[model samples]
Structures are given as structure tokens and as C-alpha cells.
Target: MDQLSATLLSAPVLFFILGALAAAARSDLAVPETIAKGMSLYLMAAIGLKGGVEVAKAGFGTELLVALAAGLVLSAAIPFLVAPALARFGGLDRTNTGAVAAHYGSVSVVTFVTASEVYGNTGFAIAGFMVAVLAMMETPAILSGLFLARQKGGRLFAPELLREVLFNGSVVLLLGSFAIGALLGERGFEPISPLFRAGFTGVLCLFLLDMGLIAMRRILKTRALTWRLALLALVFPVINGAIGVLVGTAIGLDAASAAALGILGASASYIAVPAAMRLSLPQADAGLYLAMSLGVTFPFNIVLGIPLFRWIAESLGGML
Candidate 1:
């Protein structure tokens, strides 16, 4: 319970909520766009460097590969299963359902970033390769979702696929940073230690403040999401999180890594997937998926889901 409380009330989560409230209330508060972007780059670089340092200390192994493969499979498979269920239950058409499902299946980078902080706070150690896994898991579900849409006569263009799969900004930045971090390793990290390591949490708080504003704005834009859509948004994470815990345990991850995996699995992609969906599935309502993913699920995961999954992972880790 104490652990759960700590995770839920962490500075990051609180700031996120505060940001949301400010935006929802139409307050004048706003983070500068350039600062927000700069903060994002700093956060990603810091996380990548930290992961690389951990990898340097721990060295690479097969467990990392196993976890990566498991993440890929989940990202690819979850949309297929969930989209139809959502279509049936939430009264969404095939294309919209597919778009929403893909977002849920893919990961939210903010969630991943918060999970890292949660892991550190809980004294759990995660492997560097999981950063790679997060990057890998972004695109496949999008492709799968588009495929599902196409089956229902939705357009799926070659150039669209290329833009989404290959050139998406998040994927490019994440993978590029990961590669740079790996290349630099321990020696390179030393020189940049002061820049990347110092003030990470402070920066995260500012970013979450922005996130709060964005989330609130989204909620205002989408007042009162359908109950069915809301339920799907809420429930899907628990189901996917269970799958992640099982896979992580099977892969012999430590408690922290397992919990992190569950967080990643449970998180929905608001940024990458939405951008792709907007371009690829024009008929799909962005309001439905974006609101559910960002406004509802993202907040839920940050506030409650992270702690719950961490507890579950801890219990299961002990048993294993």
C-alpha cells in the first residue's frame, strides 16, 4: 500500500494532473512550444543515456532479446484482438475501431518515461534494451491496424505506410537516441553526465505540467466519452498488462523490469499512432481514439495503473 501510494502520488503524476486541470479549466497557463519540444528531447536523451549506461554496466544478454520479442508480439497482436471487441461493444465502425485499437496496443513514450522513474523510486533495475523494445513496438501495431482498416475497404497507400513506419518523428528520435547512446556507451556518458543526468526529474515535472494542460484540453474537446469507449479504454490496459507480466516473468525479468513491461504494455500511444491514423485512416474519428488514449487512459495509467501493475509484478516476482 505504501509503495502504491508513493507511485500514485509521485511528483510526475501530480504535475500531469495539474497540467490537465489547468488546461481543462481554460487557464492562461501554457508551456512555451519550443521549451516543450526541447524538454522532450532532453528527457529522451537522458533516458537513452541512462539505459545505455545500465547496459554498459550489466552487458547484453539473451533475456533482453526475449523481452524485446515478447513486446513486439504484444504490440502486433493486441490491436487485432481488441479492435473487433471494441467495434462490437463500443459501436465503432471497422476503421475507427482499428485506429483506436492500434493506439492502445502501441506504447506511450510519456508512460514509458514515467515508468522509468517509478522503477527507480521502487529500487527496481530495468535493462537498457527495453528502450530499444519501446522503439520497436511503435510501428508494427500501426501497420497491423492499417491492415485491419484496409480489409474493410479503407485506403492504405504505400507512401503513407512509408511515412508512418519509417519516418515518424517519435520513432526517428527514439531510435536515433538509442543508437547514439549505445555507440557512446560508458566512456561517452561520462563527458555528458552533467548535462543528461542532472535535473532529469525536474525536467520531467515540467513536461508533465505540459502534459496535464494537453490532457485537459483534450477532455474539454471531448466532453463525456461514451461509456463503452471509456470502459474499453480502461479495461484494455489491465488485460494487456497481465499478458506483459506473464511474458516478463517467463523471460526471467527482475521485479522492476517486469513491472516496467506491464506499464509499457498497459500504456496507449497517443502521439505516434494518432499521427499515423490521421494520415492513413481519414474516416476514423480522431476524437474518439485520442480522447480515450490521452485524456482517459494515459491519466489512469499514470495515477493508478502504474502502482497496481508494480504491486502485481512484485507479488508475482516473489513467487517466481
Candidate 2:
């Protein structure tokens, strides 16, 4: 409860709420799209570089391998679990169901970034390798989504789509920045540390403010999001996050890493998955998936899900 309160009152979350309210009220307040895109790039690069630097300092270990495997399993398996529910309960057709499922299986990098901030504020040490987990977790759900929505006699992936999914800008920047950071190490990173390290939180606040406005506007404008689908958007994070926490605990992760894993599970991808779906499942309802993921799920995770996952991870760690 204390953690939750603190999170809700934090600068980033408050800015997000402000953005949402402004959008809901139909205010003219807006971030320029180009600036938002630039911020997104900056955030990913900062996250990647820091993660790689940490890995360099600590060196690769079994934890990285184990966490990677667990993340892969979750990303691959979540769509299978979610697609049927969307079909049976939400009454979405095959294409849209698979599309939404792919989102839950994938992750929102902003959500992860926000959670990392929350955890950092709360004094938890997130392992550097989790960024690798983040990078790896982005793609498998895309493949799973493609398989679920594959048209009869159609190839699962067109050459172009495969390229798009594999070399998406986000993935490239993240992985590329990580490699650069690893090469640089702490000493090598020192010269540019002020840029990536010092200004991270403030940039995140602005980015999330933009996100909040975008999300609320999406919800307001989209007709495809039914009540049932909205409810699933709220629910999937809790269930998936719990499973992730349990798996992390079982795998001997520390509390922070376990919670980070839970955060990843709880998040739904708005970036990578949507782009992939656009290419592969062209028939899928973009409005519906975007509304559920960006409008409904993203806010929920930012507000409540981060703290919830942290508590769950801590509880499970204590029990173990």
C-alpha cells in the first residue's frame, strides 16, 4: 500500500495522469510526434547501454541464461493461453484474437522502464541481464501470433515481414546500444554517462506524459474496444505477472529480478507487436488491439501493476 501510494504520487506517474486528463478533456496540449519518437529512441538506448554496462561489470552468468530462457518461454506460451480466451469469451475473430494475444505475450518497453524506476526508487537492484530478456521477449510472440493467424496456403512470414520483425528499429537500437556499452564498460562509459544517466528520469516523465495523452485519445476514438475486451486488458497483466513471479522465484532469481520478470509479463506490447501485426495480420483490427494494449493495459500497469508485481515477487521470495 505504501509502495503503491508512493508510485501513484511519483513525478512520472503524475505527469501521465495529467496527460490523460488533458486528453480526456479534449485539450490542445500535445507533444510533437517527432520529439516523442526521439525520446523513445533515447530511452531505449539509455536502457540498453546501462544494462550492458552492468553486465560488463558483473560478467555473464547462469542467471542471464536462465532468465532469457524463462522470458522466451513466457513470450511463446502467453499467446497460446490468451488467444482462446479472446475467442471464447471476448468473441473476437481468429485474426484479432491472435493479434491481441500476441500483445499480451510481448512487452511494453516503457512499462518496463517505468517499473525499473519504481524498483530503483524502492531500493531494489535489477540485474543488467533483464534488458537482454527484454530484447529477446519482443519477438517470439510475434512469431506465435503469425502462426495463429496464418492464412491457409500462405507462408507464415513474408520475407519483408520477417525482416521487419527481426530488425525493427527498437530491437536494433536496444541490442546495438547494449553491445556498445559492453564494449565500453564502466570506464569507457564515463565520458558520456552524464547524458544517458543523469537525464533519464526527466525524459521518461515527458515520454510518459505523451503516452498518457495518446492512450486516452485512443480509448476515446476507437469503437472496436468492447467492454469484454477492456476487462481482459485489465486482467491479463495480473494473471501473467503472477505466473512470471512464480516462475522467477522457482528459478532462484533475486527479488528485484523476479519482480522485473513479472513486470515484463504484465506488460503488453504497443510498439513491436503492433508493427509486426500490421505486416503479418493485416486483417486484424488495429483499433481494437491498440486500444486494449496502449489505452487500457499500459495505464493499468503504470499505475497499479508495477507495485503489485513488486509485492508479489517479494512475497514469493520470502515464501521460497
Candidate 3:
């Protein structure tokens, strides 16, 4: 409970609150768009490089393979589990249901990044290879979503979409940085570590502040979110997160990683998946999907889901 309080009260979270409040109050406070993008780039690169270095130190092994397979399987499978509920409970049509399912299946990088900070500062351990897991988890749900919708384009693989999904800026930056860190190792990172490592938290605070404002704005604009649908938004993360932890634990992941798996399962994507959906499921309702993810799920995961998921993972992982 104390840990939860501390986490909720932390600077980044507080800044997020401030952003929401300011927006609600119609304050003019805002982060410039260009600066926000710069922060995002810096964060992705740092996170990727740091994870790669961890993989380098740890060396490639069975754990890496297991994590990769686990991410892919989870990413692909989550849509199937959730799409039916989305259609029934939310009254969403087939296209919007599949689109929302894709978002839930694909992991949220920010949520994963936040959990990493919590684990590091709070004395729980997270695997570096999880970065690789993070990168791999980004796209499979997209294909799974398309399949569930059973709305393929003229081609099974659209060149433009494949380009978009495979080379999405976020994916490229993270994977590229991870590869670099893997090859360069800790020794090489030493020179630039001061820049990347030291400023991570502050940058995140800024980013999340912007995010809070953006999310609330969506909430303001949303007309499609019904009471039942809103309730489902909160419920999905807890259910899916628990499933993630259990799966991770079963697959020999440490407690922290397992908990992260849970968070990934719970989180709905606002960025990559939304972009792909725009291209692929052209008929889907963007306002409906993005509002639920950015407005409801993102905040819920950071504020409540993180601690709860971690506790579950700790308890279950310890029992093992």
C-alpha cells in the first residue's frame, strides 16, 4: 500500500496529474510537439541501448529464446481472447472490435518503460532482454487483428503496411539502438551513458505530462464511450495482466519480467496500432478505440495496475 502511494505520488505520475488537471481547468500549459518528439526519440534509444547492453552482459541463452517466443505468442493470442468481449460488451462492430483488440495485444512502450523504472527504483529486478521482447511484441498483434477481422487487403501482405508496421519509427529506433548496444556492450556505452542514463526519468516526466494533456483532450472529445464499455476498459487490463503473469511465470521468467508481461497484456496501444489500423481497418472508429486506450487504460495501468500486477507476480513467482 505504501509502495502504491509512493508510486502514485512520484514526480512523473504527479506531473501527469498536473497535466490532466490543467487541461480540465483550461490552462494553457503545454509541451511543444517537436520537443515531445525529441524526448520520445531519446527515451526509445536509451531504453533500447540499455536493454541491449544487459543482453550483451548476460549473453544469449535459452531465456532469450523463451522470452521472444512468449512475446510473439502473447501478442498474437491476446486479440482472440479479447475481441469477442469487445464486440459483445462494448457493442462495437467487427472492424472497431478487431482494431481495439490489436491495441490490447500490442504492448505499450511507455507502460513497459515506466515499470522498468519502478522495478529499478523499488528494488525489483527486470531482465534486459525484455527490451528485445518489447521490440518483438510490437507487431504480431497487428496481423492477428487483421486475421480476426477477416478483412485482408487485395494482398495478404500490403507493401505499404508492411513498411509501416515493420519500419515504424518507434520500432526502428528501438531495434536499431538495441542492436548497437548489443555490439558495443557496456564499455562503449560508458562515454555516452551520462546523457542517456541520467536524464531518463526527467524526460519521461515531461513526456507523460504531455501525454496526460493529450489523453484528457481525447476524453473531452469522445462521444462513443458508453458506461459498459468504460467498465470493460478497466476490467480488461486486470484480467489480461493476470494472464500475462501466469504465462510468464510458467515459462521460467523471473517475477519482475512476469509482472511486466502482465502489464504488457493489460496495456492498449495508442501509437503504433492506431496508425496501422488507420491504414488497414479503414472503416474502424478511431475516436472509439484511441479514447479508450489513451484516456482510460493508459492512466489506469500506470496508477493502479503496475503495483497490483507486480504484487501478483511476486506472490506467484515466490510460490514457485
TM-score of every candidate relative to the true structure: 0.95, 0.99, 0.97
Best by lDDT: 2
Error of 2 at 91 (Å): 0.3
Candidates in order: C-alpha RMSD to true structure: 1.7, 0.8, 1.4
| Residues 1-320 of candidate 1: C-alpha lDDT, one tens digit per residue | 88768875888988997888788678999999999999988887778767767676677888878888988998999898788778788888877877888898899988889888877876776677788788888988898888777864445667866677778878778778777777788888789888877788889999999988887788778853798888888899988887887788878888778887888889999888888887888788888888999888888888888888888888997786
Per-residue lDDT over 1-320 for candidate 2, one digit per residue giving the tens place of the 0 to 100 score: 99899899988999999999999999999999999999999999999999999999999899889999999999999999888889998998888888999999999999999888878887887988899899999999999987887778889889988998889998899889988898999999999999999999999999999999999999999999889999999999999999888888889889999999999998999999999888888889999999999999999999999889889998877776
Instruction: Give the per-residue lDDT digits (tens) of candidate 3, residues 1-320.
Output: 87688678777888888888888888888899999989888989999999999999999999989988998999999999999888887888877888889988998898888888877888887898898888888999998888777654545457888988899988898899999999999999899999999999999899989988988888888999888878888998999899999999999999989998888888888889999988888888899988888989998998898888898999996797
Badly placed stretches (over 4 Å) of model 3 are 152-156
Q: Worst ten-residue run, lDDT, model 3? A: 148-157
- Residue pairs whose backbone atoms clash in candidate 1: 19-212, 19-213, 20-212
> lDDT values of the candidates?
0.83, 0.92, 0.88
Candidates 1 and 3 compared: the better one by lDDT is 3
Least lDDT summed over 10 consecutive residues: which range in candidate 1? 151-160
Ranking by lDDT: 2, 3, 1
Better of 1 and 2 by TM-score: 2
Report residue 66 deviation for candidate 3 (angstroms). 0.2
